[model samples]
Target: MKTGKKVVILLEAVLAVLVLAAVVLMLQGKNGQDMVKVSVIIQNSDDTQWAAFKYGLKMAAEDQGIEVYIANTGETLTVEEEKSLIEWEISNGADAVIVRPVPEEGAEEMLKKFEKRIPVMLVGSTASKDRSLSALPVTESDNYAMGTALAEELLKDYNNSVEGKTIGIVSETGELESVMNREKGFRDRLLNTGIQILWSVTNRSGEPKENLPADQPEVNFVAALDNNSLTAAGEEAAANNLHGAIVYGIGHSTEAVYYLDTGNVKCLVVPDEFNIGYQSLTEISESLRRFFHKVQDKAVSHTVLRRETLFTKENQEIIFTMSQ
Candidate 1:
């Protein structure tokens, strides 16, 4: 009888211990469940490239259980206005802020304003050092490599150099670095190989500026930098009867690939934009972990991951289908 009583007491003690352990585990999990809040401000979220980027960010956030707030800088926001938005996010207790600045120079002021309070990461464009902004996380595609690839594809059909041969660049008026840099790369290679840039037109709208020289273009090429600029360039190309002029778009926007399929554009070059968006969020999460000391991963330095691929008429079918 005593043995039976002792066995019952032992079982009750074990049950009591199990209940206490469950309660402690529940409390600990509750403590660790703090939601990380992140703010992402793109230059303009309405643009296709920005939309794609936001999609990538949202996917990552959903997987990681992060809270993200997205805002657009508007079509005509000034540097001061951009800064005000950043300040507002910081004031509202954002743990980190990722921004695509309206103007490259404008980033410096915003970075100076918020660096000490929270980490600032930039997407889309390059920034000056004074801004204290992290290097844009996307891989810097070798614009020159892209230019070289285009040249090689162009050479496959024609033996003559592009030097002194007129080409037209329909680019953003200003404030877009990636486009300008890619254009420079194209110009450098073509000029070295004997090509002349007849006239470069700057467009604010997705429309072509009326001021481009009307001389007969020998092999006019369109270099659209962003999604908006790319659309405007396409419209201008179709309107201007540049239908078969060896075009090569830099960003992998759907429109850019569509042009290649329709034979409106001869070539396309794209960076790993999907990877860029995915990596940026992963890095942001890691940064948050470092700052909050919730995880033991060491803080990583600024990383620039640049990847580029050349798409041509021959491989347009395979290439265009990947992004969608």
Candidate 2:
């Protein structure tokens, strides 16, 4: 009888352990379903352009009831660092990932790996060569169109006459596809305008007032391709009193607006950064819900912000609030 009793006790103990294990697993599964997690990784997180984008991400995350993890690499990022962060996110059970990948070798392979694990929403430039990743959903401005538009606007000042006129092009880096495209668009648009490109210099170090071309003839216009170049060109123009030369560039920062107000910059091509952030998160959320089968590919539109329109009541409020 004691032997039979011992057998029964062992069976009961085993049953209890199985029940406990099942309950623990059930709890873990429930917790996993309760909250969707997303990770957003950005290169150059210190840039002011990301402020609106971050705000938009937070707002969308709160609205969607999802947890967000943000990783900002303060400097230019590399492929290895990007892969490490992505692996960490995957291990942490991130449901989706939004990243602005640095253009480098193996970027395409890394993105393919990310797509296999979780839905990826790209921002800024498409880091892939051959445009194979063009089908991926991305939130970015039409940089080429922005450059072309800026050139068109500049030409209006000269009454469409480019004869005997020189234009200087300043940019951050040639390594970036966006910068290259913008410069290319601008140059191509002016190909038949009889205007001369004084020089195109890459100022990655961002030295203030040092972006201007040396030994160049008097430039009728200066085209700064990015925010840093824009500021540098503006400062140089202001300090040198180049009032005859119209300086313009692409940026949406308060400093860019300040340059406009001070007559340092003539026109600014501003992309809706807030929309980019908001749309990226919203799309990621939808992708998570729908298994990433329905996200659409599109580019955010760019706006030409002149001084008159920039200081308008609505724009003024937006600029003030964004600066804060």
Candidate 3:
């Protein structure tokens, strides 16, 4: 009887030890053993702006010891597709999400649903003024200020006189608030300058140079407010031999730098996309460390690059590239 009792006690002790070891392993898996995952969704995957942003994000993720998953919604910018990607990320146990939404009617509602479960950060755009989304954080450029500054600088080249001078404006579809605000700011600043806005084209892709009336007053300047527009205008100017027509615009891409170097483009307003990506991820990591409520409405800076300042060796890094 004594021997049997001793045997039973030994078995119980072994079972307790095994249970304790299993609990420890489980805790480690939940805490230190696994990496925290972050999901990033971009509206347009092919854009140079997002390319820079992704570079910053990946660098930050490496520094922070975290995992980042990215998805591109293509050029259509469909809200449903964005929501589907977010849903998949959430279902797969992503701890947080960074998104550049399409700003459609249902976008807010869809984001709010995700916010209830995990942290969501906005990039290149802001959520609506809805009180419910006020807690969401955003990282983007001040488009209005950038536009106003670009116009002011361009005016200097014309001796601040609109007398017999015509400027062409190239912009996006004007459906986005950022594009609209930029156009508005530029137009408002040029209102008193008497510079006639000969034409405002809504197409941002391909060469719209043909749209510039051949018989109209000489176009003293052409301004493109987005990346695609900038490229189109620069190429058009170079191809058609449009001399003395300064092409100024917004964006920082390899092509933009090329145009600047070749003298096809005069000035470019480049937003700090690298910083935007870096900061957004860093902020999201902090939120994971403490509480999600820690990060809110954050803005990045924009730089204006001119032909004379672009190749000075000091400004080579101003343009954002995938390899950089």
Candidate 4:
């Protein structure tokens, strides 16, 4: 009788241990013991503009049981340089890669070739706006829609009576597809509105080549088309260098937010960069887990912010994500 009782106790303890182990395994998912490796490459990866995006990636990394590595990249990357970096990551045993593509000719083709070896995804701008964009998996907001929205906001401010308003357009560079598309959208919306575009300046990312005249001689407003340009515009406005022209543009960064908070920028259109980072990582992890699963293009949303609405519940959440 004593021997039989001892055997029964041992069996119960063994079953309990097995149950606990199963519970842990279930909670940990496929990465209970092994971690999937993913590498991210971005041009100027260290830029603060990527803060929200990086935050999202970090959250997804914890949830999806993957280890992520973002490569140290330069201010501008060439096609050959990007290709070499991808090759190196693969050789270093990266299970997948998330890349911010260099907007150059032949970049898409290069990425597609890497796709064959491992799962690949894109964040932010694609290589081109052609049919090739559909061929690659990407996460980003609709740049064209954002530009149109900015124009709408500006028009609303003027009550659609911009007939006497003269404006100058400032952009990081007139070359980037994003910048060009935004300019097109903004211009298309202003067609027949009688708003005079006095001048359009490109190559104003960092410190301007020349300071904007603070004297109101020709323009009534200055529109910045990208983050760097918007921030530059805001700085000029704060310092009274933009010639009292109202500042407006699309931006995503702490500095941009600071300017908006201080009432320098008239309005800001920000892409949901957090969602871009989170969704991209989640999709890549899903593909790694399920080989048959195919990731598709995800169009994230954007929000137009003004100083008064900057700290609302919803926008505050967005600000938090970007700041942290």
Question: Counting only residues 3 or more apart in sequence or on different chains, how many pairs clash (N, Cα, C under 3 Å) in candidate 1?
Answer: 10
In TM-score terms, candidate 1 sits at 0.70
For residues 85-183, could you state the per-residue lDDT of candidate 2 as single tens digits?
Answer: 888887987878888867677776777677876788888666664344454567878778888988988888679887888888888777666777788
User: Please, what's the RMSD in Å of model 4?
Assistant: 8.3
Models sorted by lDDT, best on top: 4, 2, 3, 1
State the lDDT at 195 in candidate 3. 82
Top-lDDT structure, candidate number: 4
lDDT value, residue 247 of candidate 3:
88
Residue-by-residue lDDT tens digits, candidate 4, 1-324: 699999999999999999987765543334446677899998788889889999999999999878999999877787899999999998887888999877677888898888887888988776665635446788888877888999999999989999978988887666555677788889989999999988887664333365343433558888888887788789989998776789888988999999999989889999999999999999998887765688777789999999999878999999998888
**Candidate 3: misplaced stretches above 4 Å?**
1-30, 127-135, 204-218, 241-245, 320-322
Model 4, position 322: C-alpha lDDT score: 83
Q: How many steric clashes between backbone atoms does each model show?
A: 10, 0, 0, 0
Q: How accurate is candidate 3 locally (lDDT)?
A: 0.75
lDDT of 1 by residue, 1-324 (tens): 699999999999999999987675443322366677778776555655554456667777888778788865556555777778877876776777776656546566566466556656656554542212333333234444555555455554457555455566665555555555556666665656666666666656434456442333545555554445555555556666564555655555666655555655555555555544555676677766554422111121111111123344534433433344
TM-score of each: 0.70, 0.81, 0.80, 0.84
User: Which model scores highest in TM-score?
Assistant: 4
